[model samples]
Target: MRIALGVSYLGTAYQGWQSQPGGKTVQDRLERALATFADVPTIATLCAGRTDAGVHGLNQVVHFDAPVERAMNSWVRGTNRYLPDDIAVQWALPVPATFHARNSARSRRYAYVLLESPVRPSVETGRVGWVFRPLALEPMQRAAHHLLGEHDFTSFRAAQCQALSPVKHLHRIDIGRRGPYWRFDFEANAFLHHMIRNIMGCLIAVGQGLRPPDWVAAVRDARNREIAAPTFAPDGLYFLGPVYDADLGLPRHTPAFDWLPL
Candidate 1:
């Protein structure tokens, strides 16, 4: 039987989403937990998106072929028993064999939460990116406008990114601020590695008056990574999850979505 799970995790302690030799990734822990629950030597899982170290996942979807039949709820409660406190299985469903967690996704969403204050983050240290300087909403919004459509994002992509193409269709970019907190939302057909973080660095630069709004357009057109701002920290990045067809009957968001400051 093919099974799908909605998992969430605090990525601060993990190496990343993919399995590694040290077995310190979220995938490693999850696969081991699934294996233990099924009484099998191993059970591999494929996730809709891979998050980097220090990034969080609000609802990461994964699918694995089960060797034994079990109730859907059992998969949630059983696998979670062996998982760490910071990681958990939120929901589970039976999917058709033709369904793929990654390829079937229509679009993916991400959010970056930033704390704009002279004081460094205390209670929310690893949960938010910090910027000491005050930010202007107008400049950042204008800069974001340049990235709203399909374009080559080589300037924002990480050098290590293995994506076949740098061209991606950015569906939306929403920038909102509530007091000292700033939230940036991105929806796209897909994102290159460190794409959002790289953009964040550029946006922050414009917000701080270090660069003009038109500089963003120039950077985009240049398609040169060196000319753009440095990649921002991954601490505040969150995979809001992937959007799939409604006919598939998958949950769109998890409860943790409400917890974000946005």
Candidate 2:
């Protein structure tokens, strides 16, 4: 049977989401726990999106096929028993065979939590991105305006990125402020490699008065990676998860979503 799961994890310790040879990746640990719970040799999972090292997942979606029969509730508690504290299965669903974790998604959302303070993040070290310089929200908002809608994000893509197309539809970029913390919400049909992190770099530059709001459009027009700001750190980048059809009966949110700056 085909099964879908809502997963949440702190990516600080794992080497990104995809399985690696050393077996330290999130996919590695997740697959192991799943196989152990199912008493199988392996049960591979496909995630809606893969996050980089040190990145986090508030609600990540993945789907796998099960070889054995088990109650729906057991899929959550039983599989989690073999998983680490940082990794968990929030909910599970029996999905149609045609359902896909990645392709079935309509859009993906991510948020970059940033802090403005002289002292770096101590308690929330790997959880939040720190900017010592106080940022102006207006300029960043102006810069974000140009990023909305469809555009070729070549300048913001990573050199090692394997995505075939540079053109993507950026549905929204919402910048919200709360005290010393800033939350940048990004919603897109899909993203190129390091797209959000790169855009964050440019937004920060404009927010810090290092660049003008129009500079963001200039970078996009240049279609040159070097013209854009460097890719921002992955520390604050969280996979807010993908949106699927309600009829699919998949859980889109987790408890971690409540703890975020959302």
Winning model by lDDT: 1
Q: For residues 1-262, could you state the per-residue lDDT of candidate 2 as single tens digits?
A: 9999999999999999999999999999999999999999999999999999999998899999999999989999999999999999989989999999999999999999999999999999999999999899999999999999999999999999888899999999999988899999999999998999999999999999999999999999899999999889999999999999999978778888888875
Tens-place lDDT per residue, model 1, 182-255, is 99999999999999999999999999999999999999999999999999999999999999999999997999
Candidate 1's C-alpha runs over 4 A off are none
Please report, as a residue range, the 10-residue window in candidate 2 with the lowest summed lDDT: 253-262
TM-score versus the correct structure, for each prediction: 0.99, 0.99
Cand. 1 Cα-lDDT: 0.95
After superposition on all CA atoms, what RMSD does each candidate show versus the true structure? 0.6, 0.7
Error of 1 at 121 (Å): 0.5
Residue 144's lDDT in candidate 2: 98
